[model samples]
Target: MEEDKFIELAKKAKYASKKIATLPVGLKNTALLNIAKNLKENQEKIFEANKRDLEEALPLVESGELKQSVFNRLKLDENKMRDMIQGIIDISNLEDPIGKTLLKRQLDDGLILTKISCPIGVLGIIFEARPDVISQISALAIKSSNAVILKGGKESINTNKEIMRVIQEALDSTRDFPKDVLTQVFSRDDVKNMLSLDKYIDLIIPRGGNNLVRFIKENTKIPVLGHADGICHIFVDESADLEKAKRVVIDAKTQYPSACNAVETLLIHKDFKYTTELLKALEEAGVELIAKPESWHTEYSDKILSYKLVSTLEEAIEHINEYSSGHTESIITEDNKNAKIFMNAVDSAGVYHNVSTRFADGFRYGFGAEVGISTNKTHARGPVGLEGLTIYKYNIEGNGDIVKDYVDGTKSFCHKEG
Candidate 1:
């Protein structure tokens, strides 16, 4: 697809999203239920498409470029499919973010000032081999009243196409949403086209590896919501309870080693009392330890981990500020003051206290499902949920009120609600 075609499609989506923004929440929920039903009915088709992708990806996995977990995420198992449906159903139960009044104030005589949430219009998503993203992000966008354009990695093109087809079938059965509201583009040129459609696309969310994110950021005219890497950190302060720190650190690194929120660096206080015991525990667990001097600023996404010794909280803060991917960072300490200080000082999307960085998720944060883990500081941060998918607008009402009358002394009016 050409850039112009994507821009054209985005234009149509912007118009469609406005209509969806006004759609009743009940109707939207019904559509979500329908989507879940459709996905369940088409289980075999979904897995077959995924299997095709995996069969091809086996070579890539063996080459060491792709992690085994990536392959696992790509395969659509029975449980994962059920989880995807439940995710959609969960989103349906949440209150619609659009059309909710955020603030109300009196601006002038008979003029009602209101700020309310609204759809972001059109959204562009660039992702990796996670085909379930088709259902997940699509569900959130629909609930939030935004149109979405998706671009999956070439390796998962077939899988994405199959998923999109199912989604369209659901939408068709429901007939409550415009088919153009969601689409998948297969070409690299189409992705480039999507990046250039800023006039219609309000935001571009890139969810994948560093190079893909960087490419999207560099090429897009639209503002991107992204984090290039997940160089998460776990700092164990001297005041930390050894048992708590051990549990949290182990869970953070080993829970799902290949995930974005997984801890890649472990920092221990130079005076950390249980250094020997903690080190032995981590080593025994099979974490490939890379010490400082050799472990320059890095984001080891696999089983690899970097170990650093910090003399004080200040040093820990410095190390994180210098090396972290600004994703999730955690500090384990029993002292209240140290925990507060560390939480405030760490420059990360999420700062944890005596907890695993893995807890930095939209679902864990009470959102039904996450669109992505955002490391960006503004617009959206942390786990992006339905609320993150929207923007706000000013809705001002006046009863034959004139700006000139309010400006003039004779007509100086009190700012009060009717």
Candidate 2:
């Protein structure tokens, strides 16, 4: 019975997805701006709802039923609330991602083939905590012209419900807006149903810890887009400036230790002159540095950092490629030659030089917001924004075009690339 209900809901979302796919950019922007306005107006109610969620989550955190990192994400502070509203408005200002011409080719004398960007039907979003994500994802979906079914963890159910309520009310108030564009589902069974109905859910985007992403990858036939771990790394080359290296490393790890982009591993060239000072600075910054550990794949999503000394830049790149999560990696160096080499050699979604890995964010990257940082080699990589959510379709225009005519040599394709 539960499966039937979910299937029905999925069908409606699929129907809604088609309707919104052709929506004009003005209407979409109106819907997004309304969502931002409604959220701004209902801040008090939303905070009250978040307070209830935090009250329930605290006991779980104390009993070890939930990690404190998750509790931090669960709590919706004033800054997060303000950012959430601003993100939606920012998205409304972004250029429309749909129906843009990607390619144009002359297939024949009168036949012209064009590739246009289009929505990717429906998106199934499974996230844990981070209720602020609801607004961001909803705004991105609206701007990208894709329907979404969001399944948030039970831990922040109250906050999720209230936020969704405001968003839905906003959508409802908008003129000529399609219904079922965003559906919020709960229960483990909803997850199972989402995984099973690959035809209905075009993509599965899981936003949470290693386990949740892995489980979605294992269970779903639908295409999954996300990174399981964020074992990011930062390497200090022999020519790295001591002061700049210290500042970048400190900000990367200690600025927001719980962030997925936070640097977890520190690598220093053996010949680096300021290695001792750099390590000392990190220790003074309250970072617990572990040296030469038994495992290299650990993602210490906390104040703890793992360190290693390598003889050369190649060794740092090699270590990063071996155990790094392919999320993000950065190199600190004054030598432009070595910096170029490090940036090219590191096999991660994001590679930086003379900067902190914390800059590997969509909002910081000026994408307004992101669905998530994807480590996948194909489709999309790094921070996935509006353009990432769209796929292209080929269309041919001709008075009379037949495959048989072209196959029989009566006519031929000009094959002009544009």
Candidate 3:
């Protein structure tokens, strides 16, 4: 937990980053597939380790010291295990995001300029409860040819350790794979030390509660790539279908209420005729609806929802743009024009029409998997998969080219791109 030890790990990751940056795509995919196979083989070991974490977390949940939603995320079921392994396989199947030629230019005669995609050097990830993030991030970093150091919450320590062990075992079996491409740190001090080492860690991705993310963003000189809050919303327009409204709202709220993409606020147009019926359907499904104005900014992460009726579609758009955490938002409507207007006007990472906000996911978006979602304007936004983990650099191959010639206008240069 010492800062020196953490710095050592960061340095190793940086070294490993350079080593893995130019690896052939075939080796990366093989390593990823090996990880998936190992996870499938060692799932029982992981489950047993997860059980230990749950045993310790249960008391905290019962005593109200920990939120039940967090405990729910801490426990990994067979479904989650399957999804985790399959996600790794899917990532392996994705086109390698690194080393692709993004742009090519003919600078001049016997001169060429090329821009190619490359890894982001090193990533420092701090997340809570979800031990699956360990495997997902390892696969993504491996595929993207980036090195990563992970810091997980104490609640899932046993699970995280076991998953990382299996993943490392798989990586060790991989031919010529870098050893320190993935590192794990657990301790409050590790976080503090990680934030200070901006020289080594290129990006800090915090995937947890708002307070944890806010703390990291405030204290870190490293550029942070994550949203602090998941205050998502869904607006039901006046011409909305009653059935579609109920279906989308129910799925978005109850499908996996603890998910970051879950809808926390509902905005209904006042002219919508099925208000009473819609509210009744929600209550019958065990949703605790609150109409309080102050709850608009709240992320319940539970079956609780805060809702309000708006006078018009414009009002609904204004409210969402004002209070949404720039995460995901949805509109349930039968009118195509209204849906287009709402979709175009809302400023969020994802905007959907007549669909659940739960669709805001990397795997669901067909990017294989994600390290985390980003609300940042620059760099990665939405689900950060392989593409987001990469940046590009210019590579020019010239034969005795001189800037002085161009500067002095002795020879006019042609800037042509192919």
Candidate 1 stretches with Cα past 4 Å from truth are 64-69, 293-296, 413-418
Give the per-residue lDDT digits (tens) of candidate 2, residues 1-418.
Answer: 2999999999999999999999999999999999999999999999999999999999999999999889988989899898888888889999999989999998888889999999999999999999998998999999999999999999999999999999999999999999999999999999999999988899999999999999999998999999999999999999899999999999999998888999999999999999999999999999999997778998888889999999988899999999999999999998999988888888999999988999998888888889999999878999999988999999999987889998899988889987
- The stretch of ten residues in a row with the least summed lDDT in candidate 1 is 409-418
Candidates' TM-scores?
0.95, 0.98, 0.98
| Residue-level lDDT tens digits of model 1 in 1-418 | 7666767777888887777878888878888888898889988988899889988998999998777867766777887788888899999989889888888878765678898998888888989888888899999998998888888877777788888898888888886566678877888888877877777888999888888899888887788887889889999999889889889888888878878899999999999889889978887888778786455556666777888898889999998999888899999888889989988988888998999999988767777788898888787898999988888999888877776765676476566643
Instruction: For candidate 1, report its TM-score.
Output: 0.95
> Which parts of model 3 are misplaced by more than 4 Å?
none
- Comparison by TM-score, 1 against 2, better one: 2
Tens-digit lDDT track for model 3 on 209-268?
999999998998999999998889999999999999999999999999999999999999
Q: Candidate 2, after superposition: displacement of residue 223 in Å?
A: 0.5
Q: Residue pairs in steric clash, candidate 3?
A: none
Give Cα-based local distance difference scores for all models: 0.84, 0.93, 0.93
